[model samples]
Target: MGCGACMTTPRKKGGERREEFIYHRMDPTDVHAVARKHARGHYCLCPIHGPDDDADLIRDTYKDLGYRLNHTEFFMIRSLSRIPRVVSPVTLKRVTTIKMAERLAKTAARRQILPEHVDAEDPPMRVYVALVKDDIVGWVNSVVADKATYCGGMYVQPECRRQGIARALLAKMLRDDRKGGARQASLLASHAGAKLYPVVGYSEVGTMMVLTPKKK
Candidate 1:
């Protein structure tokens, strides 16, 4: 099934048309509403809980649920605030750098395989980066389908994890993506992301594994 309303065609079997919803840029006023939804577990976004009321149990809570922290994959907003002042910027930079490198590697890998499909000059993709106190803290990549968007790489630096920075960034993107006339957004999640994605309103489609050829 294709996303008749957006840019790309859907690749799923069921032909079920998942329409994207309204998108708008979230402002400060929206935070309260977002927090409320999170508190109720109805938000379906990550960090899967209300504002950090009990930091001590946060790790235990997820652990009890058998959720393992893909330390690198967890784009936690709460952790953003919890990070010590001295280390936040350094960590954010490391994350941004790794993310950029990964993107480049992925692009290089794709280039080698010319996929009988994509053009040599694939269009430039845009990813959003968010900062706390002017320090890079969170990031997410987005793609278009018809008018809708499929969110790609979403991550927050390890030192900045769990501090609501990611949530804030995501809320902003969802609003912006929708306002751009996108009806829906989707993304594949990592292990730690498994717990977070559902909290922010993403449902699992299935799983995938990537195997790359080793260097000769």
Candidate 2:
């Protein structure tokens, strides 16, 4: 409602113009509203041809939803391993205070990421973050469901990537998953993120296909 705007724009393939709409970012309520419009309940996407490992499909998904692509993500799961590499130089902690959430919100805003209310009173979700002198440089989190533990919300400061911060964050996620009696951990990884998950013992189970809504 208060987060989007619309205007006319030329089509990508032809001379005809069309209305372009975008939701710069969505809160939890906004996410649910889209799902409700789609069907009776939450829905998922199915690839038309197959996984392309490109951003085009994801882009279309945003256009159809009247939202632009903020991140191109892939799907993965943690594989069974005798040992998971423990990366260092970063301390991990679960987000539990408003101060932490405020800091994370600022970081996500700078990155143009979709914001989630990660720090709330008795929050239902858990977010683990990597701290560098009380500043969040990287983090990961998961939501446990009846079927599996879906891990996401992974981010590392631009200057912090490739420094083992992501690896350390994921390792902590897996540890938390096991601690909570979860047997499987899954995540939708961004294109750049695909590289980081594998090092933490996750494998590509399948490629994710993002589809846009059709015109009426």
* Highest lDDT against the true fold, candidate: 2
Overall local distance difference test of candidate 1: 0.43
Candidate 1 matches the true fold with a TM-score of 0.42
lDDT tens string, model 1, 71-176? 3222222111111212222223211244444543343332111122122233223455655655555676555566556665677768778766665555556665
**lDDT, residue 68, model 2:** 35
| Candidate 2 collision pairs | 74-189
Regions of candidate 1 where Cα sits further than 4 Å from its true position: 1-125, 213-216
lDDT of 2 at 32: 35
Q: Write the per-residue lDDT of candidate 2 for residues 83-190, one digit (tens) a residue.
A: 386867778887766667667767665321123545454334578889998887886767776436877477788997778887777777777677666678887777
Clash total of candidate 2: 1
Best by TM-score: 2
C-alpha RMSD by candidate, in order:
16.7, 10.7
- TM-score for each prediction? 0.42, 0.60
